[model samples]
Target: MEAFTLSSDFGYVVLVVVATVFLLQWLGIQVVMARKKYEVSYPRMYSDNDDRFNCVQRAHQNTLEVYPTYLILQIFGGLYAPKLGALCGLIWLAGRVAYALGYYTGDPEKRNRGAFGYIGLLTLLVCTVMFGLSLLGFI
Candidate 1:
């Protein structure tokens, strides 16, 4: 196995990582803004069981839940499948955005509209595991 050269190969990984981080940060900011918009007061922490706040917070938490796995799969996969990994990462970002929008609408039933993001996440997971195994001489 060849060492991952930090030239073009690692460059693609960095690009995708940065983009993913940016997307995640953007979503987090939106959650904070939602807190403000919904009148979830500061220092209180909890949303007082408010439905709008609940939806917004849950949408944000949902993203937080998947972010770590997505980042790991994305960066690891990027190391082996740069173009495809980046493309999938972009797709994942789009999925997260769709999920957020669907979940943010203050409707629990409509949240499934954003569920499509998992497809991208699963694809990334497969790519990462496959490439990772190969890198480990297991393939």
Candidate 2:
């Protein structure tokens, strides 16, 4: 573990990223526990026949699939553009939440409600390029 001070923009982004990562982990736990509730035995088979289970499970899996890229982008991007990184991180969090809620409890046809998270992801990707350019003194 490294000690950090949150006074700089980079540190602030780090804080936001850490918080978002924690939430993703928490969501994962929620889904795991939820799956357990669906099964007759713990550590049992996985099924998605139930719409509710499928919804949450899908949301969890989808988030997991996206989380790594978000984390990597956040870390490298925040180094050069911390404020933008923070904003993008927050947006990603919001988008993921909207995606999960819409997927878990909202209409099936409205899955696009949570798609805004991609904008944040793209922004981070650009920021990553910025970081790379900064390292190369091209920016």
Q: List per-candidate RMSD values in Å.
A: 2.3, 4.3
Q: What is the lDDT of candidate 2?
A: 0.78
Clashing pairs in 2: none
- Candidate 1, 1-139: lDDT as tens digits: 5775633756666786788677778877876887788788776555876787777777777788878888899877777677777777777777777777877787877778766767777888888898879878899
- Could you estimate the TM-score for every candidate? 0.83, 0.82
Deviation of model 1 at 35, angstroms? 2.5
Candidate 2 stretches greater than 4 Å from native: 1-7, 40-45
| lDDT (Cα atoms) of all candidates against the true structure | 0.76, 0.78
lDDT (Cα, tens digit) per residue for candidate 2, span 27-108: 7776887677666245533464566666777788878888898999988878768888889988888888888878767355
Q: Which candidate is the best by TM-score?
A: 1
Minimal lDDT window, size 10, model 2: 40-49
